[model samples]
Each structure stands twice: as structure tokens, then as C-alpha cells.
Target chain A: MALPGFLRRERIVARPGFNRWLIPPAALAVHLCIGQAYATSVYKAALVEDFGTSQTAIGIVFSIAIVMLGLSAALFGTWVDRNGPRAAMFTSACFWVSGFLVGGLGIETGQLWLLYLGYGVLGGIGLGIGYISPVSTLIKWFPDRPGLATGMAIMGFGGGALIASPLSRQLMSYYDPAYDGTAGTVPNGDAVAALFFTLGAVYLVFMMFGAFIVRVPAEGWRPDGFDPSTVKQKALVTTESVSAKNAVKTPQFWLLWTVLFCNVTAGIGILEQASPMIQDFFRTGDSSTVAATAAAGFVGVLSLFNMAGRFAWSTTSDFIGRKPIYMVYLGGGLVLYVLLATVGSSATWLFVLLAAVIISFYGGGFATIPAYLRDLFGTYQVGAIHGRLLTAWSAAGVAGPLIVNSVLDTQGEPGSLVAANYRPALFIMVGLLAVGFVANLLVRPVASKWHEPHSDAATTPTPARSAAR
Target chain B: MSTSVSKDPTPNGQQPVHTPAALIAFAWTLVGVPLAYGLYQTIKTASTLFTG
Candidate 1:
């Protein structure tokens, strides 16, 4: 908790002729201002007609802010690894601007449990410490491209919902002139409490300019002519460290947490029914045949293939390695979920090109699992084992939208369903990409009784690896 | 670590890469003017659902 004095930690490092690409735009100015949690479905139909409620109580305020962003990134991931990223980006910009100033005084005092204790448990502990505070200071100043410096700050959490869903529909059409964010208008609720107090004072000045331009890499900062033994001769790349409580007593951290819970439960069975499963897989009956502005142009081409596969397949997992980039994301996501369950009703640009390459391997398995936990546990508790592997993305965001909305609500709704009622939820999302291709073919290495016994570079030496650089 | 590093490096030890042009036009309009106004409101509602 040191910071103050022009955000200390030695005037945010990089001084030696600065510019380590100015720390990926200061970690994309705090992940495109807390990737406005995928533009909270542009304020879920104005918080269900301004608190009239039920759309499952406004989808339990984004499922309690994604289960408090996986229980405050597994309970303050080792206090943002022993207080660092500028005191965890200034305590995540004061609990994400006091969770939008107590959720805009709980929507100007109507109070749905103080907007579920201000934006679901203090803005899910400011989206779990501003999402692992500048991810271990960009994997310690890009230790020679830690998966393209954590895929340029997890492609600013998919370009913060393409800049907060058209800037929250032009700030709720300039504070509601009888509202307009579609569906039979009306909901103003004091213009969504002045658009959650102008998105909590513009994400507290963009997460205090990513906590005063974050820093951290000093001890033997390598880069020039890298040569970490040519990335420790690739395959199962490790230098060894471990410790997020012995990385949850490894089996290579529960096989990379069941390979990121079966690749985010098979790309959240097509991002929780993308715009009514492409207008219920191309309707064709009494009325509909894909409209609502072409299912919002197929959810804007699946958010440009989930922000171009979080920086093109996590910068091609730094020249193909992180377990063959999860063997091309679970064996090319089990042939794009059996070509969207047998030729996804054969069209609509072949089911929008196999659900945009299975949502770009579900945003390149969350920007390549912290450089595959910094190549099997090393960069000392890779942002606390990527904050305990985002509790397998809050258990695949409640088991991939309850296995695709309870198998397309027991084969019905979605404009009187068809495509063989989403072929049994696309064959249970191809048996969750064949159980994330056998947990990325059982990832190995981290054995020597969970390393860290003083950075065990084979029972340490060289004056404790030159006093750990 | 050299009084918390910075302030030297060049005589072979790297670290000079700069990037000024007003910090690359404020980090490319801080993540490109909201991805160019979200791809101009998703290609103006996807060019009337792909020209038709």
C-alpha cells in the first residue's frame, strides 16, 4: 500500500529510456475501462424497465457481477501478489469508483439492495482487482513477449464492449429524451441514475490512468537480446516457481483448470445464445426470417471474432507453443462444434463461419491463460496463478449459460426453435470441445514436488541465480 | 536493483525504444476512438444486413 507521491514504486519503472511500448498503453488504460463488463447488455433493457424487474430479476445483476468476478479473483489474488500493480491499480480505482457511486445511489433511491450492494458486490471487487492488475506488470515487462505481452492487455477486454455499447447508447440518448435503446422505449429511471454517475466518473479517470501508468520490473530486467535459453527450448516451457498455494496443488494446476473449463464451456455455447441464436438459427415460419437488424448483424460479427481472437490467438501463442495453443483451442474446437451440429442449418454464411471460429477460440482462451501460467508456473505466481484461474471463468459463467439456456429451454422458445432444436445444444457444445481436447492432452511438467523452494533452478546455485538477478 | 531501476542502458544493455509522437497519439486515441465508434456502429447495422 505504498503508492502516493506521484504514484511511487520508483516513478513507475521503465525509466531507462522508457517505452516498453509504454506498457501496452498502460494496460489498455485499465482494460478499456474495466471492459464495461461486456457492455452489461447495454444496461439490461434499462434494468428491466427501470426496476419493474424480472428478466430473472434483471439476470441477477449480471449474475452477481459474474460471481463477484470469480470471488474477487480468488480472494484478492495474493493481495495482487503482495501489493504491487500500483496498489492493485489504486484498489481498483477505489472499488471501481465506489461501484458507480453506490450504484448511482442505488438508482436514485429505488434500491434493489443498493443495486446489489453497488454493482454486484462492490463492482465485483472492481472486477477482481482491475482484472489482475496489469497482469504481472505485463508478464514482467514482456519477458521477451509473454504471449505478446499478455495479448496486449487481454485485447482491452475485448475492446471494452466496443467502447461501452455505442457509448451506452449515446449516454442513454443524452439522459433520456423519452429513452431509445430499442424495445418499446420508456425506461429512464432518472436516466439510469445519470448513467451510473457518468460511468463512475469515467471509470475514475480511466482507472487512474492504469494506476499512474503501472510499473514493477527492475531486478535484472532482461530484454535486449533475450536468450532465456531460446524460451527454455519451447515445449512445456518452464523456469519453475509455483506458489499460488502450490498452484492449487498441481496436476499442472488442474490441467490448466480443465483447460479453462472446457474452453469457457464451449465458447459459452455461442456467447449465451448470440442474438437469439442468430434469430433462432434462421427462422422460417409464420413470420421471422432473421431481422432485428439481422440479429444486430450477428452480434456485430461476434464482436469482430471476439476482438479478433484476443489479439490474433494470443499473438499466436508467442510463436506456437503454449501447448500448441491448446492444440488449436481444443482440437480446433472439436471441428467447430461438429460444424455447428451438422452443417448449422446449411447457410447464413455457413452458420456465421462456424460461429466465428468458435468465438475466436473463446477469445483465445482468455488471452492464452496468462502465458499458459507463465509457461507452467514461473513468473512467480503469474498474477496469482491468473487469480486462481478465474475460478474457471466463474465455473464457465454458470456452466455455459446453463448448458445453452437449459438446452434451448427444453427444445422450444427462440421463435419456435428448429435446427433440430439446436441439435441437443449443439451436441452439448460438442461434449464441451471433447472435454477441452482431453484437458489439452493432459498438460505436464510442474512436478519436482511443486518447485519454489527458493526458485529451484535445479536446486539453486550461481550465487542463488546471481541473487535472483 | 540499481535504486529501483531506470536511468541507464545502451552500452549494449538495451532499453531505448522511445514511442513519443505524443505517446503515440495518446495510445492511439486510447484504444482507437472506441474502435472507431464501434466499427461505425457495426458497419451501420451491418450494411443493411449485408446489402439486401
Candidate 2:
């Protein structure tokens, strides 16, 4: 299918002297908007009350969106690559905004399935497409510092929730004066619906601004003084191109996939039950010393670490190679989990510190993988390959929560469960991280057979390289 | 074979478009303010975990 003239890749190529710095903010715009997916808990209770549904039913809405994020990224990744960022961003904006509108209608009309269809399925597609659209472009423009460039953008994904959580609360409070987003004060359904519409409108403007301003670096463009030979010297940083099709055939892809799954699984073990897990861990007989307010604060602290780690650890990959970074994220993470499992309950500060670092590694794992893929697969079809790789995220999303939740369930009921009950689940995560550490250790360069036949560097050859030829 | 590409640095031969420093600052401000707001709010909320 042909893209419209305005959205064509060729139309948006940068002219000489165009600033590459503009691209990261454009990527941030889209990511910050879709990052709202993480803030659904703000209105989750209201949705449950409005529909008189189980918490599980309300929770499925988020699960479906996450599942769709993985699936659509896998499916539409190639189309995004073919059409370019503008078209993909525009398409994502349409779906994402429409999702809010449709979900609002569902809330107003009292239809749960409409919420699922609109927010889960439609909005999820937006998440997938929006996530990967700017990444490869950033990699292309910042080949000298791909990790830093990609990290700056993916950091926005972590930061989005930070913005959306508070913004949603304030907006909900504005719409319903009685609701203060406190423990007992759930916003009414209508207020929640209105909040969705307002967010959708605001996000559409930001995402469209991103789409309008975003441009691909022109072919053969390189920052004036960059030395590609310096990058070539980095271990496992491939100069050869590999198609998305062939990427799946390599063991390196699966190894990294395992690495990501374990990292995410361990992280989600903390994230999924962050609030309750803290309370449960510190429980003293019938009553826990930790207040609900404090638990909420714990979650907020974790978000800060998660966001900071995306930028910090991923940029650190530029100095230390990608493989070594994974060794830190997974290997160091192994010890963190054991500490979190064993002695975390001994002190409140100790517990919070361990969980925060674990979540940071989790966020770092996400931001660094794109650069790792660039290292092994080269830039050709990297976005597509990234989209495919997110399926591991979707899988781990389900598996992580299940492992923790089920273990907790078997141990005892939710409110009554104490620190000892969680040890099994935390130990399980420790094992998973050990598996991921080995997988990271096993990552080797893509074999020559997998390289595209025309695997010239994906960018145009330099004048010097051309002269040598 | 020498791979196919335009030897001309700017493919369309357009004049180099100089992006003003102010424009870059404005663009950064547009995204930065909101992110800053979020960080402030989260920090304020998270303060309770320690203080309480």
C-alpha cells in the first residue's frame, strides 16, 4: 500500500545543516503520550465501581493493551520501516486518540467490551508503532552514540507515567471536586471518561507536533567529525546489515530475547505488586507499620529510578560495551534480587534501595537492547527487529505478574500475607535473572551467513571509503 | 562495484538550513517543562515514604 504524499519518507529527509538534536524531543513527545498506559491504576478503581466489575476485569484492559503493544509492533514494524516515522506517527496518533474517544463513549454508555476494543486493542497498536518509530531514526542520526540517542528517547517512555499519573489525578479532581485521588476517594465514572477525552485531546496535539517536526537524516549524512572506524572497533558492533527476516534465524536474537524477558520479569515482579508487596513485606501481625500513603510513595520512588536508569544505564553502554552492560543489568541484578528476597524486610530503607536498583536495571535493559540490536544486526530494519523483540516484553509482562501473583495466592490471601510468603516468588525471580545472565554471556556476533547479500553499510559510503574502493 | 549514492552532500542542492539556537532552546523547553513538573510532583509525593 502506498503512503500519502505528505507522509512519505522521501518528503521528510533532512537538508544539510539540519539539527539532529530536534529528533529526541520529537520522540519524547510521542513516548510521553503513550506512556499514559502505565497510569491506568489512577482510575482503575473507578472503572471497577462504574461497571460493578471485578478488579481483574479492570486489570485486563491494561493487560490487553500491553499484549497488543507487542503484537502490533511485531506486525506493523515492517510497515513503519517502509513508510517512515511521519506516517507511522500519524497513524499512531489517529488510533491512540480515537481509543480515548471510543473508551470514553464506552464508559458513558456502560459497555465494557467497547473499553477493551478501544483502549486495549486500538490504543495498544498506537503504543507499539509510536515506541519504535523514532528509534531507528535516532540510531541512524547518532551512529557514533546510538546508545545515548536511543536512551534519551526511551527514557521518555519511563518518564511518561511520571507526568500522566499526577496530571490524571489533577484532571480527575477538576472534573469531580469530591474526588481527591486519595485512598478512599474514587473519581466517578463520568469524571474518568472526561479525563480520558481531555488527555486524548492534549496527547493528539503533542504527538502531531512530533510527527510534523520529525525528519529522517538524509542518506550518507554523518556528523562532521565522527569516525566510523572508532565505532567499528567496538566488539560485536557489526558493520554488516542483516534483514529483519534473517535476524530471527540467529541465536543471538533469542539469547538477547531471553535476557530481556528475565530482566523484565524480575522487574515486573516488583512493579506489579509494588504497593501491596511493600506493605506485605513489612506486615507485623494483623497490622503493618507501613501506611497506604507510604506505599504509594514507594511506588513513586521506584518510578524515578526506572526513568533515571533508562537514560543513565543505556548511555553508560556507550562507554562500556553492550554485552558488559547486560552483565551488569542481569548479573548484578541477580545479587540484588537475592538481597531483596533474603534481607529486604529487615529495614524499610534497605528494602526500598534494593527494589529501586532492580527496577533501574529493568528500565536499563529496555533502553539498551535497541543499541545491542544495532551492534549485532546493523541498522537495516532495526526498528522492525525491535518490534519483534517486544514480544518478549509482552510474554514477560504476563509471566512476571503470574509468577508473583500465583505464588502469593498459594501462600495466602492478599491483605493478610507477610514477608515470608513473598520469599518464594522473589527467589523465583532470582533464578530467572541467573538464566538471563547466562544468556547475556552467550551472545555472539551474527554469523556471516545471516548478513544481507548487499550488506554494505546501511548508510552511504564515505568519500574516503569510496576512494579506497 | 561502487555502491549507488549521490556524491552531492545535499541531494536536492538546497541551501543549508541553519537552525537557530533559540528554536532549539524553545523545542527543548516545550518537552522539558512537563517532564520537570512530573519529576517535582513525584519527588514531593515520594518524600512521604521517608518522612512518614
Q: How high is the lDDT of residue A4 in model 2?
A: 81
When candidate 2 is compared with the true two-chain complex, its DockQ is: 0.36
The residue pairs that clash in candidate 2, if any, are none
Question: Model 2 compared with the native: what TM-score?
Answer: 0.96
If you superpose only chain B onto the true chain B, what TM-score does each candidate give?
0.32, 0.73
Q: Candidate 1, residues A310-377: lDDT per residue as tens digits?
A: 88898888887788888888888788788878888778888878888889888988988998898888
Best by DockQ: 2
Q: TM-score for model 1?
A: 0.35
TM-score of chain A, all candidates: 0.37, 0.97
lDDT of 2 at A283: 96
Show model 1 residue runs off by greater than 4 Å.
A1-10, A14-29, A34-136, A141-152, A166-170, A184-204, A211-213, A221-277, A289-323, A341-343, A346-357, A360-362, A369-469, B1-52
Question: Candidate 2 chain A — worst ten consecutive residues by lDDT sum?
Answer: A460-469
